[model samples]
Target: MEKPNSSNALVCELINKGTREWNINNLNSWFLPEDREAILGIPLSSSNTPDRLVWAETRSGKFTVKSAYALALEEKVHNTRADCSDESAGKIWKTIWQLRIPQKIKHFASKAARDILATKSNLAKRKITPNGMCDLYVVKMRKQSVICYGAVIMPKKFGRIAGSGVVIRDDAGEVFAALSKKWKSPLGAIEAEAKALEAGVNFAREVGIREAEFESDSVVICNALQGLVSPPSSVVNVLAGIMNEVSYFRQWKFAHVKRQGNVPAHLLAQHAKNVEDFVAWRADCPSLIEHACMQDKM
Candidate 1:
């Protein structure tokens, strides 16, 4: 048999089998305090739903422009207040984001306002200590504009198996597809996150998306996808699978997001625990997650 990808014990595999209880020996053998406690805390599922793997994308599994725009606005707002204590400055974010300008330009404007240019202090913030100030650096235009938002739910109070969700929105920020998937075996949170992206990429490819962007709440997974960092040893295989799928696309982007910015996908991931039949939605929002989808537009 192939070696298990992670050193951690699989949640489903740790059951006492016929006795239907946790295998305490394996739990103790495999996990540290927090992980063990979290594993033990998983609420058993009454539905006994089989695990699922579903794919989707627009542009989805949303972590990119939306989150970046929000982050930029947040940073701009915070910096303005810190520098001047002027309440009026708080509206700068609103103003920048609300501009009639193109989305890309507005994002750039936000970055400029954030003082992201490598000035002496900014370089110092980066630990670069450069002697001088520095400076730095869509699509099918629409159809090709695929961005992904992906979220993962740990095995906690919800259910014994981990789950993940992906929502692929169009360039207009309208949801075009959604999916909630259960991991085949118990997976670490990050591993499940990588699984979510893998699902999104497969979805994109299935629908003949030649170019796409993907987003996730896990910075490690995003960084690995973007080649910004080496993938962790435990998730190497999962990341590898994602990269292989990504090769099919003519273009692709990876981004990191905070949990709040990824709420819809997070909700879908949480929904996975109770879904009786795994299915992917198209051209419509799943009612349970519809409100969250609408909220993403604002």
Candidate 2:
């Protein structure tokens, strides 16, 4: 940098005049031996075009605070896990606490895990309701399990790629399994919905869930499944495939839900953008949809 005009010079200026090679003379003139060696050791691009900075964390070369925070949190988790070999076995607690739900929910889960929840026994010792059950819990009771699915396009309005999310939970609102997946170049929105259902059925079968309610947020797809509306041309093949799988279920039903009611599945669909073929969890839900799952149950 002390050499005249070296401080402001671009790297392209140091390229050899007639070849795709480093200018040894210019490097020697402007840089110390170590610096010159490092420069020479750096791989040169085949293209001679001017270089530009790119953010590796995003699909686009743009940076966002959300991505940065996620990266930081991931690094923290990795480092913490690396530092405490024994605690690696305690990730179940980490999963419970890191749930994206409200603090009260987290507190309740922690208490339940410790047998300190205000259950009937605990409440009998106190002055609260004898059952110690909230309306949310009471209302969630069901006779059978249900697998709900949702779909989303990456860019929402115009993108061709899509995400498919599936969540399976019993009538008691206990999650059994979850799946998040990315699909490439779907024909359209309805097709994407069919794809999500397809993935859900496949996941359900793979996980040995023989019979359950099938739910989705796409009205068109659900109506088609129920034969209330004719299946559209774009979704006919995919929807048929879903039925072929649904046939294996001893009992099954198709259900439609609005966007808000399908938060867990919807968020899981959105989360699909971050995974490759898919992400799955058994007897556990992904932290990415923790808050959404709570919201859905509520």
Candidate 3:
């Protein structure tokens, strides 16, 4: 057979033509010697099974837009490189891509890798004048004492219990406090989110913050907090608790934000799964989440 290209169709055709089995004898005739060796190295099932496609880039063996983008970027970089032998950049990309966090977080990280973000320093380097526009300026001016806090919850899965993370930051986007806790029992995502909000309120109260703004990725939970919708029975008690805590604040608001804006809390929630109990940091953020926090500030 002619040399096979790196196209999915070509790979599938080769596998299909080999009687749908990956044994050495069947694949040897179709693949080049190196490719045949690689195929043989993969462990095949003893029982008869149909062939299936797997995206080697992801642990789930499923295709994702992020993976496709990464593949295309890798090809572009390879073609632009002088030697094409150094893989340091590829190794860094793989490390970030393999993170177990949400896909949106990974997508943002990928953009950071490409230096696409237009930070003030980057604009200066490009000799472009900054508009001096700030998205959070109005909110900062309205409530000098107002602090924004993000809450996220990771539902129990793969033998892990529900985990919640909360991050509190000042108007200057500096972290004042953070929390991570793992629930003993499994809770649905909405319920866990409500719990996280409640925890955030309690933390704010403990810190004696009179004005606060709570943010969450879950629109349902944020709406319930804003009285825009009635919360389900499962989270009614938690909602009530959150409302009571809200009374402690002189002024407070709940806002629904996209996942990209809530990466710090999301990272904390995922980190909570591995810990045995809750953890709190005061006047500081965890080293592991510093990168996400910097991204948010940018």
Candidate 4:
């Protein structure tokens, strides 16, 4: 007769061992004391010299028995139950899965994990880091005479585009969309961007909206928004005022996008720059920005 495979033999050996309160301590040594007790209960001490002990650790900073051996003991318990019939053996086997479910959930950085494991052997040379940056495309343009900035919004549904936005606030709160006017100089760009964010946040807040994500291509505005440095005199006080108004939001994230992607906002702003009097909305959009919206529909 052919020899039995090691896995099958091991299963059979475990079945023969049976559950007479087997050494759970060794199987759970890796888990914390509370987790160990939660899963395995207290160990059954024995006076006999032959009784064996072993232990292991768990992620929650506790010690428990080695998991595989505990699984072996659980398998033995179900196998030796007399009332469990031969035809019901598969059902009994499924019970072993219950013990392993929790242990299977741990996540790790895979490429880095492989690199570290490779160092323990003589097989490979490359050390890999599995982290990458979020690619940002910023499009900036003139609508009428206004300079606008924009970045794409990722949609909840996959493979789709949501609306985009111009960064109105840097450190104030969540990102929002708004209408802005054209500025001829660098100082103009900074003040205009800050005002746009303040306008957008106030509009959103009036409607009870909270939390937002904002992005911009202007490094000057971005750095100022983050409070990494001061904005020029024309913009600082307004930026600070906007921050106070937006302080109720849960969080705000500022991102920098490249200029090529900020086109839509640029178009809106360019249109707004020429208007004599600004109304926050025209047919649900700022009247100054209506031309840009109409052009987009076309």
Reference-based TM-score of each model: 0.50, 0.49, 0.48, 0.34
Tens digits of per-residue lDDT, candidate 2, 1-298, equal 3443345557767876574556768776765543454354332322333444545445333567976886687557545653425676468678867888545456555554444443445433332222544223111101112887777755534333567778899877878999887754422355566667777888899999978888776777788889997664444555666777778988888887656566677777777777866889999878887886776676
lDDT for 253 in candidate 3 is 83
Model 3 poorest 10 in a row by lDDT = 136-145
Question: What tens-digit string does per-residue lDDT give for candidate 1 at 1-298?
Answer: 7433125346577776664445657766554443454454332322233443221111122345654665667577657744635568657766767888544355445545656642446434433332343222000000111445444444334444556677777788887787776543444445556656767787777766676677666777778778887665445555766777777889887777566566677777767777653568888888988897787778
Task: Please identify model 1 stretches exceeding 4 Å from their true place.
Answer: 1-146, 154-159
- lDDT of model 4 at residue 75? 47
Tell me how many clashing residue pairs each candidate has: 11, 0, 0, 39
- Give the winner by lDDT: 1 or 2: 2
- Which candidate gets the maximum lDDT versus the true structure? 2
Q: After aligning candidate 3 to the native by TM-score, how far in Å is the CA of 35 from where it should be?
A: 52
Runs of candidate 4 with Cα error greater than 4 angstroms are 1-187, 279-298
Residue 183, candidate 3: alpha-carbon lDDT? 53
Position 99, candidate 2: lDDT? 81
Model 1 residue 254 lDDT? 76
In the order shown, what is each candidate's alpha-carbon RMSD?
20.5, 24.5, 19.7, 25.2
Best by TM-score: 1
* Residue 222 displacement (Å), model 4: 1.7
**Decreasing TM-score order of the candidates:** 1, 2, 3, 4
Residue-level lDDT of model 3, residues 1-298, one tens digit each, is: 6443322225445443333334434455444443443343233222233455556544334667987887677657645652324599677767877988655456555545555344534433322222333222211000111333333333324342456677778888898888776554334345556666666777778777788877776777778778887655445555766776677789988777666556677677777777886888888978978998888788
